[model samples]
Target: MLEGKPICGGVRVARDEPIRYVCADCGHMTTTRTGRCPSCGAWGTLESEASSAPSKRSVAARVVSAVDVRPPRRLSTGIGELDRVLGGGLVPGGVVLIGGQPGIGKSTLLLQAAGRVAGTGASVLYISGEESEAQVALRAARLGVASDRLLLCCGTDLEGALQNLWDVSFVVLDSVQAMRAEGEAGWPGTPNQVRAVAQRVVDAARAGDVPAVLVGHITKDGRLAGPMLLEHMVDAVLTFSGEGYSSYRMLRAVKNRYGSTDELGVFEMREDGLIPVEDKSGLYWNRSDAAVSGVAMTIALEGTTPLAAEIQTLAGPTVFPYPRRTARGIELNRFQLLTAVIEKRCGLPCSGHDLYMNVAGGLSIQDPSADLAACAALASALRDVPLPGGSCWLGEVGLAGEVRPVTRLGVRLREAARLGFSRAVVSSRERNERVEGLEIVAVSHLNQALAAGLSRKEA
Candidate 1:
C-alpha cells in the first residue's frame, strides 16, 4: 500500500508532484503555498490536500427534455412571511442554508418552522449538533411548540443523524459548523469538514426527496463562517438580519434556485414565537398628526411590498471645525452626499450645521427613491420648518440636484394613497397616472420638490 492519503481512497499522486492548497475560509484553490488566503484575506487558513487523477472509467450522460419537466411543489413552512421570502414555500429535496449572528433568531425561526411542518402530520427531524435535547425541548415548550411528529436528535455525527431522513418529511440541522462527518479529516468547522458535511446532507436530502434546512454561523465580519463552497452547495441561501435592540427581524434570500431573491420576510420576536408582520409599512411610520420639523415620509418598496418610511433629520450649529454628520438606518456617506447636494443645488446652508439623520422604526432604507425624502428632511431640519402635512416625497436626487424617476412608481403611489397620504411629490419626467384620492405633484428639479414639500400651501 502506498504511504499517502488519497482524496477518494483510490488514487494517489506521485511523490515529486507539487501539493495543492485550499483556503479553509473561502475554498480558493492554488498549487502554491502562501501564508495568507488571497481570496478572503484570512491569515493562515490554507491547508494542503492531495490531488487525485481522473479515472478512466466513463459513464454515459443522461439528458432530459425541457418540455417534459414540471415545477416542483412547494411545502409551506407554516409561516406566511417565511414562505413569501422562500418564493412561495420549500421545494421537496431542496436544501436551504440560513445564516445569522448569534441570538438573531435563526434557531428559533427554524424550530418554530419545524413545529409547524410537524403539525401538518408530517414527521420532522430536528438534529442539533450544538444544543442538547433538553435545551431544545425547553425552547420548544416555551414556544408552545408541542408536536408529536416533531423529532429531536442531539449529536455531532451528521451521517448518523441523517439516517432518519427516510422516515421524516422535513429535517433541520441546528448548525452545520458543529456537525462532523465520520471519515472527514480535521475537526468540525474546518474547511474540509464543513464541505464534507454539507455535501453529505445535500446528497441525503436529494436521495430521500426530503426538504432540509441547515443553520449556519457567521464570522465576525458577518459572512458565513465556512468555506464559500458551503454556500454554493446549497440550493438556497437566506440571511436573517435585525438589530439586537429592536424586536423586528428581516429575512432575505440572497440566492434561490427556485424563486426570486427580491422577496423579503418581516418578523417580530415576541414571548410566544416569531410572529409575521403584515403591515410592514406601519412599523416604519409613526402616522403622527403633530407635524414636526425634520420629518418627511417616503413610499419605499421592499421586494413587491411597499413600505411607508419616515426620514427625520436634525441640524444644529456645530462647535467643531468639521461639522459632524451622523446617520442611522441610512449610510453616512449618503447622508453627507445629500447634505452637500442640498447646499450646492438647493442653496441650503448645511455645512455649518452638525447634521443628524435617522429612519424611524429602526428600519434601514436602501431605496434610492428615498433620496428626495431624505433631502426634504435635511432641509426642513436646517430651516426648522415642518414638511407640509399629508404629503409624501418620492424620487432619486442626482448629484446635479435633478429629481430622477424611480422604478415601480405606480406601486409606490398606490401604497402612499393606501396609507392615507393626500399628495406625493415625484419627478416630473415620470409618466403620471392618477391614483384615486392621491394628488401627484411632479417636479423636474430638487428646488421644485423642496418648494412643493416645504411650502405651507399645498401644491
Candidate 2:
C-alpha cells in the first residue's frame, strides 16, 4: 500500500543489517546487539564481523600408506627433575606448557634451563612479556646465568620474536598470557588472544623444529589462566604445585603425547635456583634410633622411583559427641575409611577418639599401598604401642580388612631395603623372593599386619 494513500506525505526509513557479534572472552558466537557479552558477561568484548562465508560443498584429501617411525630425539633441559617430568627431555618441534601460581618460580626454572642449554653452545631465546629487559637481566645476573649464547627479548611482540625463532635452538616464552597476536581483537590474556598467541607460537615452534616451553599463569582456582584450548594445543602440559613459601615444588605431567604421564619431578628451591631431589625417599623420612608409636614408614612409587614417606597418626580420647578426624597430605575420606576398618576389623576403639594423620615432609601421597602403613600407624597410636624398628609397610587394606597385594611390590621393598628398612609388612600373596638383607613379613589380614608390624607389649 502506498504511504500517501490516506495520510500526509511520508518517506521510507532505512535500517542497518545486523552484524555478527563474537565474544572475545569465551569465543561465544551470536547475532545479539547487546553491549555486554551474553556468554561470559564481559562488557564491550563482543567483536563485530561480516557474515560467515558460505560453507564449502566439498573438500579434497590425500591418502597415504602408514609407515613405521622412530621416536623423536629429545633435547635435555639439563635439569634432571624437569627432564624426568617431561619423560626424559623435550622433543624437537614439541610445545610444552608449564603452569603455576604467581611467584612460584616458573620464570626462574625456565631461565635456569635456558642458561644451561646455552652453556652447551646451543642458542636459546628468553622471551619475556611480563618483565622488561633490564629486570630480566638483573635477575639473570643474580642467578649467575652467564651463558653467551642466551638471547633475551622483551615485550609482547610475538610476531617479531617468531621472526628469529629459527635462529635459536630453543625458545622459552616467559608466559603465554602476556603475549598477543598482531591482529587479535581482544587484549592480551583474553581467551581469543591467548588462543591465537598459543596457536601461532606452537606453529612457529613446530615449523622451525625448535623445542618451546611456555610458562602459563594459574587462575585462583589453580587451573591454567587461559582458554582451555591452550592446553589442548600443546604437546605436553606440566603443572607445578607446592606451597608458595615452601622450598619444595612438585612438577607433574598432566598430558604427554610422547611419554607416560605418571612420571613426576621433585625440586627444592635454593639460592641458586630449582635443584632436583636425587634421594626422594630421604626427603620425607627422619631416621631415629628408637622405635616410635604412631609413626610408620611406607614406600610410594612415582613412575619408577620409590619414595619413602612417614605416616604418623595420633589418636586421643575425644569429648565431642562426634569424634574428630583430621588428615594432612592424604585424603580425609580415605583416612576415615581406614579408621572404620581398624575399629571394626581389629576391635580398636578409634570411633571414640580424635584422630589426626599426617604424611611427613608435606608431600601428598596417592598410592594405595600406603594403606597398610596408615593402618599400622593408627593402631599404634590407639594402642599406645611402638611399631618394630627398621620396618616399613607396603600393602593395600581392603574393606574386608584383608591385606591386598599392590603393584611393584618388589620395587618398593628394594627401595625400603636401600633406605635401611630391614622388615616390610606386605600382603600374604606377595612373592617370597629372598632379598639379601630385607625380610618380608607377609600377613593376610589387617590384625596380622598390625601384629607383625607392631612389637608386642613388654611382659
Candidate 3:
C-alpha cells in the first residue's frame, strides 16, 4: 500500500518471505529462520540487513577442524610462574581479563605477555587506545620484544582495529577504558559506552574466533570500573594485586571459567621486567633463622600450592583515646577477632593496645590456617617476647579458644619442614607427614598453642 492511502491510516505491504536480519551480535545478516543468530553465534538480537557473504567461522570450522591446533601453537611465557597459573600455556580462543589499580603495571603485564606470546612465534595484535603510537613504541623498547610477530595499532576506533583480525590470532586491548565508537556521544568507559563497545568487541571476537585479552581498570574502591556484567562476560578474571611500595607483584587468578580459580602467578617488578617468583616459599622464608621480633611464619594456600608466610605483629600502649588498629595483607576484622579471643581466653590486655600485622612478600594469606600465627604474633608482642625463629604456626583459632584444623595440612607441613622450621604447631587431628629434622607440635586447644609458643620464649 501507498503511504497514508489505507483506510486504517497506515501504509502496508505484503511480502512472501520474512525480511533478512542483521544480527547486532555478529553484525551479519541472514534470511534463514532459527532461534540462534548464525552470524555471531548469539542467541537472538537480529535486525534487518541484506548480505550474502557467508560466515568465515562456518568455512573455517569445517576445514580447520581437520587441522590440529596443538601442533603449531605452543605457549612459553618465559616467566615460569605466570605459565603455571595459566594452566601449562595459553589456549587459542581463550579470553583473559587482567585488572589492577592505576600505575600498577596492567600495561606492563600485557607487554610482558605479548613478549612471551611473540616469543613463541605467535602473531599478536596489540590495540592501544590509551597511548599514542609513539608512546607504545617507547614501552615496547623498555619491554624488549625480540619477536617480529608483535603488531601494534594505536587507533581508538574498535571497528578499524577489528578489520585486521584475520591477519592476527590474538588481540590485546591495552585498555578497554579508552576505546570509543564513531558518533557515540558518552565518554569512553562510561556504563552505556562500556556495555555497547564491549558487546561489539565481544561480537567481533566471537565471529572471528580471535582470542582477545583486555586490560580493565579498577575504580578507586578496588572494584572493576564498569557494569558488573563485564566480569560475567569474560572467560577469566585475574587481579594483579600488590603494594606500590614493594617490587614484588602477584598475579592471582581470582576467577577462571575454564580452569581452577585458585591458581597464582608471582612476579617481581624490576628495572628489566616482571620476573616470575618460582619459589615463593623461599622468598617469604628467607630470614626464618634471623630471630626477628614481631614476625612468625604461617602456612597458607594460594590456589592449590601450600606455602609458608611470615606474619608480623606490633603491639604497644595506645597513645590516643581510640586504640589504633592497622592491618595489611589481612582483613581487619580477622585481627580484631583474634585479639578478642586472646583477651577473653588468655587474659592478654589486647583491648587497650595498638595492633598491626603484616603478611610477608606483600601476598595476602586468606586461609584460616594462619590464625594460629596471628595469635602467636599478638602474644609475642603483648609479652614483649620474640617468637622462636625456627617455629611456624597453623590452625584456626575459634571463639572459645580451640585450634580448628585446616585442609591440606600435609602440604603446609611439608612446606614448613622444607624451609627448615625446627618446630611446627597445628591442630591435633590434622593430616601431616612426620618429617625428619623438625619437631611437629600438635595442640588440642588454643591455650596449648599459646603456652607452647610462649613457654619457650619466656624461658
Give candidates' CA RMSD values in order.
4.5, 5.1, 7.9
Candidate 3 global TM-score = 0.77
The candidates, ranked best first by lDDT, are 1, 2, 3
User: Which model, 1 or 3, shows the larger TM-score?
Assistant: 1
Give lDDT tens digits, candidate 2, residues 1-459: 353233335645443455897765566789877888777787876778678445768576766555655567899988988888888898999999999988778899999899889889999999999999889888888788767798988999899988878679899998899988989877899877898999999999989999999999998888888766678889999998888667888889999997889887888988888888888887788787777789988999888889989999998898888999999988999999999999999898886899999999897889999999999999999988988888889989999999999999888878887889898888889877566699878899998888766555432
The global C-alpha lDDT for each of the candidates, from Candidate 1 onward, is: 0.90, 0.86, 0.77
Residue-by-residue lDDT tens digits, candidate 3, 1-459: 454233344535443334686544344556776777765466655545444544557543455555564542534555667666766655556667788988778788788878777777778889998898778777777878746788888877888988877767678896887888766556888655565677677777767777778889998898777665677677778888887678777787777765687887777888777877767787676574566567778878988787778788998898688888888988999988988999999888876788888887676778888898899888888888888768888899899999999888777777777877788888997765687777889998888988897887778
Best model number under lDDT: 1
lDDT of 2 at 124: 96
Candidate 2 shows a clash count of 0
> Which regions in candidate 3 have their CA more than 4 angstroms from the true location?
1-78, 132-134, 182-187, 282-294, 317-326, 347-356, 360-362
Error of 1 at 337 (Å): 2.4
Candidate that would win on TM-score: 1
